[model samples]
Target chain A: MTWQPELDELRAREAEARKLGGADKIARQHAGGRLTVRERIEGVVDPGSFHEVGAIAGQAEYAPDGTLKRLTPSNCVMGRAQVDGRPVVVVGDDFTVRGGSADATIREKPIMAERMAHDLRLPIIRIIEGSGGGGSVKTIETTGRANLPGGVGGTQLYHYTGANLSVVPVVGLGLGSVAGLGAARLAASHYSVMTKETSAMFVAGPPVVKRLGEDLTKQELGGWEIQTKAGAVDHAVESEAEAFDCARRFLSYLPASVHALPPVTTPTDDPARREEKLFTHIPRDRRRVYQMRPIINAVVDQGSFFEMGRMFGRSIITGLARLNGKPVALMASDPFFYGGSWTADACAKIIRFVDLAETFHLPVVYLQDCPGFMVGLAAEKAATIRLGVRAMAAVNQTTVPWCTMIIRNAFGVAGVVHQPANRYSPRYAWLSARWGSLPLEGGIEAAYAADMAEAEDPAAKLAEIEERLNRLRSPFRTAEAFWVEEIIDPRDTRRLLCEFADLAWPLLTPAPSGLRMRP
Target chain B: MAESPITIRAEIGASVWKILATPGAAVGEEEPILILESMKMEIPVVAPHDGVVVEILVAEGQQVEEGQAVATFRR
Candidate 1:
């Protein structure tokens, strides 16, 4: 009369599900230098904090007497887990189970994970691998039907997957050969990472691609090097443990969802501290390039800057950092690349980054040194100006509090778009700052071309004109006319930036940014 | 481990301004191998690792395209 026998049977089924694809398949997975889905979940989340939702929802074979004979668990292992003690919906592809193909999947489980993240207002972290519930040719034989795409999950799965972008922070990690839906899932995220040795992401794997006349290995087809360099993924890590650490660190700055402001940590570094190097960081000779990262590190909370999309956009650097323990979006110019002129790829990066900032309600701080949109035929072919205008629109439309520090060059339309017009945005400039429609070196030749051509000594006239403009070009003259904002000593940058962060903290709201984010 | 020859390429199209490292010269990671002038700014092309420069493929005042090999080294 006791229900203990049924309880025992339930426990047995749960244990059977935990075995994943069994010992031999799991061994093969291990031999490939990749962790199983369960191991990945354990490595990423708090120890023993995983609360699984569906442990035994899979195909089960029945005995002749109506007793359960075998249970093959679903390939999608999803549950709620604590990352840095914050609850998140973690969905991982169990690649050991039939390469995590559609034949081995229970689509509802992944759909439920997405719904949980969206409804609960929690972050979603996808530990992606294999085909990510995408179909296999064997599925046609198994079902005896060629199923239409988006039919199995009823489109709600795709809806929630895309909807989660505006509602919560989504992080995708490519831990192995992620194809089809897995690639889409990885690309559609606030942040994404892939392992250098183990991960490859593409719409399809090599076998299908080979029929298109391109024979290549998975690594050659869609390796981390190819994706990260192309900006298809944000980061490429050396190991799974490093990827987990990156995920934890990235989440540490943001709130659980867009319904909350970013988490503020207790300040460890002194806000008033100023580095002496800032004074001499920019060379007096404006033609020489300098490292912008060191300046960023010195101004933000020490070691808090997390850079993204480093390989794709060489001119503009985008990242997140803390100012006096308050998280903020950071944009700076890397003068080493095209003299910090915005390229087509850099412009695209800007749009995505500004959208992320607006979505999360994080205030933005730009260290400006833009010369202009890139020129030359390559730039035209890539539609740099068109993308640049879109970048300008993205910046102009943001409602977040903004602060701009003109460290050096700020010329042309690209330079003027540093902050939105008709807003109470605070702008600071260093003594070395320079701003104009164009630099004197290039402007004089263009503007005074007729005057120079008419002169007996054109070269001398050009130099004389340049010298006269150069004398008037001192940033003090601009400050005197109030054309530029306050020009302060470089050593005071961190102090002023910290003050801006303190001011911006109160202005941030937990409401969603009404505009749709472009992933 | 045996050192292999690694080619360092120009990241942007620019005229070579200064050759900072010569063949057989030892350099550290991120140490400038040369400087290229573009858009009125001097951009540095740096060593990929601690290595000895095997050759300088581009000369001063020469215009090099992006992705063109500028130097080679063995780490």
Candidate 2:
């Protein structure tokens, strides 16, 4: 006899799972200016490439005749999908179902998705909303008890969430009100993004936090502005569509996993291209500040620079770009903020970026222009020097090839980290480069105080000392002493960098370092 | 008023060196509205979007704390 009746039942349940959270709940989701989980997956991955798992795993109700009446699908919609034709795991929370709370969750589904990414060595993208199966007080009522902090399989959830970082690339997108475990998922990613208009992330949301006597709106509490400025999230976009675009672009610069080299695309921009503006880009006046972003855009492959955490670390710019079709990490100093000094926040930003580059085996190109570590009481309170030491250690321990160009000011201990010690790496200095333990203008008064005080005309004596020191400050003097490396014309920057990229590509090996990525 | 005006804040503690835009002046995105002097360098404060300057709360040579409102604008 044929088993066509059972086959028909299976098809019917799969169709029921496709109707996520019913029509009324989905309308409410749309009314709040957010998309459903299935829609989000479709927007982020390649068209018609999603293969959903556990489609029929959910609560089922049966009638008195021993036949199924209806099925309510699980809130976690997870599956394998392709991004730019590369396989990846996508796990999104269905906010239309029980507000994506733990009460309606099948806990094994999300854990299984993370396990799949870990075993298969594929990138995992988390589209977080609501709590992402985190704790809900309603769960206590449903089970008739209050359990411990970690749910039945929650430790495994956290384990795979963290272990996947060392093995493969992990990205997270905060698309709506996300709390607790959802917030942790977003924070524990190689790159994370949030929409400015529709996303808010926090450990606990407003209602619970209101008991602490702070009556604040969701936007005021943990909006895009607060999270991005606090360095909890990397980017904030204007819309969900833009957020998806960012995820796609970020993956383009990285490989599917640490076991493989980043894929190289055909070069559209000429490797020998050089801009004449670089020759006069740095202002003649030492006190003036010039834009650094344009200089970065001019040197790398055209329109390939992707900057991250722009709001948090205002002084240092960290991003990824391609040179001669090979991926490389780019770091530069912005003179507009504290004269490009290393603040505590900037140090933390650099540490994370350096770790990412080292883990992925991407060569680093640092455009040096640091004045020093930030000075004064605020700097001390923020522990700038402690973080600076940590940054130095991070740079010193990196095994990837490094190339540095001294574009402008380089002074003090912060400037000494242009390249790691005990390593022979390529380094270049421009005609405008000036470096020392301290800048000459303010340093003269501190060093020759006695000489000026003893002179009959102190002003003239000071001027004489300054003139003599200025002549010795020329970069060629350092070049003659062999203290600095080769000095080159600014117009030759791109050509020389492209040559370095050619040399660097052969040095990158895909063998795993056995070191876990620090989140 | 179709939308609320956006207030531009001083990002660092500095004295206003120059005010480039006047009240009711039309400015393009990223055009410098004023300059601030700090850390022996002149830093520019630019418009967040293409907008008209509606008000100047701080004048040239005035000392401004970080996060102080320096100007207001409408898109």
Candidate 3:
């Protein structure tokens, strides 16, 4: 009388989908020592907080009596879940079912997951194991159809991928071999994590690429090593548990969505705790190189400087660090590496890192110690100037609050990328700062190359030329012109940065920016 | 577990101004292990981690080329 039979039928179909390609496939997944889709969600989010939707959207087989038969679930399982008590939409790949391919590609599952994150104004976590919502060559055979690449309403995914960059934090966790659309989703994220032991992300799998005759495993081709170095992925971990922990930690620094201000933790380190070592840390001697890392550590909140892509761009250091426990994106030039010059790789790193800071509304703190763009035949061949200009464009486009502390040697075009162009920096300060068309040594050598060649005592003439130019290159001379804003005691940097953070807080937009952010 | 060694290298051609680390001495990450004077600038070869100095390869006043090993740290 109550239609209990139909309700029971609904339960039966859900149970079938939950089995995930039946006992055989689930066993294989376990044999691989991997968690299923539901398990990943369980491990990633709070206990018993997962409220799933579209659970039985897979194709169904019916019996003669019209009762439900075996079912195949859509490989994508999307739902609302709580990660550390805040709501986030979790879209996972159920690899046990059709290898997490779009065999029963109910396209709405992924689109809805994305739309849910945007509509609900919550952060989205993608647990991508395979091409769950992605395409494959075999899709033409499976669905008996073919289509153009990212064409015809591909704009749907584009809207979220671009919009969410400024609207909400999108985190991607690549846990297995990810291809096609899977690779796109991973790269689209503001932050990405991969499991070193199991995860691989690429446009196509090794088999499709076998024609090249490169016998490489999935990891060898697109593992964390390759992707992270390429700046396609942000972080890597030894296990899925560690990856989840990183995701949670990263979210803790950001708001659930851009509609809210980024969370600010109470400072455990004193805002006015002057690092006395800094007094002598950056030696007054212009020719000596001191480690930039120590000065950074001293100024930032203890244990809060989380560096990103350290090895890829050695000259420029980019990371998220807390000043007075307020998160800020920090970029500093390391004097030891190429004299803190910007190379093509460093320029690319800047583009990505600045995009990250702008998308998430983090104020940028640039420790500008650049000696300028890398020069010589190598630099020209690498298109250093072209990419440096592109980097300048990225900096110019960023609307975030930026403060630059010119430490030393801000010489050429690369130095200008420290802050937004055509605008006064909110709080631009200098410490042991030096700036000009070029450093005295290099400038003199190049400009007086002919003069030195013509002089009989070339060495003496060069020395005299450098002595005459040296006075103009002094940082104090630039300050006298009022070109530089302020020269402060190095020890006071921590206090000043804290003040700037508080000052910049009110300027941050408390809602999704009206515009969009592209990767 | 034994602390793996991290080698400290000279990033530019310079004459070693001073040796800041001694065997078994405690050092903080980014603290200078040695100072190299080049281009009229003083550059510090710093430790990469909180560790004890394990060995010193170059002596004070020694000339070292770029990427030359200067010291090692057990971190």
Candidate 4:
């Protein structure tokens, strides 16, 4: 028997599903300056590469004669797609379909999307909008009952979130207003991006909050400024297009999953390439503060730094960068903020950054210049020391090869946290590295407080004490004691980091598989 | 309504390293008024909002204490 008529019926159903939420809803989505879910999926993944798994799983109707009438497709459109030629699982929420709310799609759809990535050990990208296919008040009216949460998809969601973190890189992009489950999906990612204007992530929307008599706009409540600063979101861009670009760039550095090492492109930038500005950016004066970003740019492959948690912890700059086209996590102290001191937030930022490196099996390169956990009553109140020690635990947990370069002030406990303490870090280099239990500027005053008070001239005694202590605090003296390993020129940073990457990858490949990428 | 001048204060005790914005230069929120060197660390005195620098109260090499005015911006 010929199957042409049945094939024609399948073609018709596919076309209806492709129509998404129909013209009116599509127009409304566009009026809000938002791309439809299908458009977002196309924009994020490689063109024409999305081979959808469940294209017709939504509401359907039939005529009295059983002739097909209409179909409203499910909000979650997920399947295998290539991101920059690497295979990945892409899950896009169609906001036009009841705002991707829980009423529009079965719980199994999005959960299946997450589970597909987990079982296959593939990188998963979630294009989230409108509560992440979560709750809708309309459900109560439709179902004739208001049901409690936790009975549906909760265990699978948890398992996928944790499994995805350990086994593969999960990316979440907020292209529109997201709340409840939507916000949870975005926050669960290794990297998350949100569009500044069209997207906001919150527990509930404005109308829902009106019940409490609170007046707030979505932007005011959970916009880029609030979510990013809270560290709930990793990056925010000016537009959805920028968010897509960020997701693509983020996945480019990671391997398909944690079972293999990250992909390395053929080196175009010379491994020995060095910039002279590294010397200029690092000021010669001991008391002066110089820009650190320029130095970070100069050392890594040109334009390779993809910074994370920039707004939350300004003092410490953490990002993924490539050394000779080999993926690596790069952490640098930004002297511009907090003199690169490890504030409570900065320490938390460290915990997350190191976790990303270890989970993804990327080598870590630290450009350390921290004085210590910040000193003050405010610092103590913030529990900076407690968070700082937690950061040390995260650093110690890093099984991947670590290379630390003491750019300047490596003083106190925070200084020692630069490299994993469990093993002899493969390469610990110093460029004008200065280290001590505490800075001589503030330490001498406490030790010699009595002597200075008793001196004939307090100012002269203070100066004498400082001069004596400063001589002893030199990095050269430490090197002579074999406390530090190498003191290299600033220009040699790129070559050294490339060497470290070269050393790291081989050790990584032969290791056991089936471990989770610790988020 | 006429704009008022907002003084940018030093949050930490420091000696001014560089005057980042000259008088009359437009500045945005969190933009540095000047780079301050203190305890061998560089701290920036940030502007509170979009404004034009009306005056620089602290000069290069001048020591400033916490709460000392570093610059005045017309907002």
Best by DockQ: 1
Task: Looking at model 3, give its docking quality level.
Answer: acceptable
lDDT of each residue in A237-282, candidate 3, tens digit only: 8988988887887787788777777788898998888988988877
Interface RMSD of each: 0.7, 1.0, 3.1, 3.0
lDDT tens digits, residue span A49-109, model 1: 9999898988899999999988889999999999888999899999888898867878788
Q: By the lDDT metric, which is better: model 2 or model 3?
A: 2
Deviating ranges (above 4 Å) for candidate 3:
A1-6, A150-155, A283-290, A427-431, A511-515, B1-75
For candidate 1 chain A, which ten residues in a row score worst on lDDT? A152-161
Rate residue A355 of model 1 by lDDT.
Answer: 92
Worst 10 residues of 2 chain A by lDDT: A146-155
Candidates ranked by lDDT: 1, 2, 4, 3
Model 4: docking quality category: acceptable
lDDT of 2 by residue, A1-519 (tens): 999999999999999888889999999999989999999999999999999999899999999998888889999989999999999999999998888876676989999999999888889999999886445887787788986767565688889878788888899999999898889889999999999989999999889989998898899999999999889999999988888898988888888888988888898889999799999999999888998999999999999999988988788999999998889989999998888889999999999888888888889999988998887778899999999999998888888889999999899989998887758889999878999998776788899999988999988988999999999989999999999969999888888888888899999999665557877
Collision count of model 1:
0
Better of 3 and 4 by TM-score: 4
The residue pairs in collision within model 1 are none
Query: Clashes in candidate 4: how many?
Result: 4
The alpha-carbon deviation from the true structure for residue A256 of candidate 3, after best TM-score superposition, in angstroms, is: 3.2
Interface RMSD of 2: 1.0
Assess the local accuracy of residue A301 in candidate 1 as a C-alpha lDDT between 0 and 100: 96
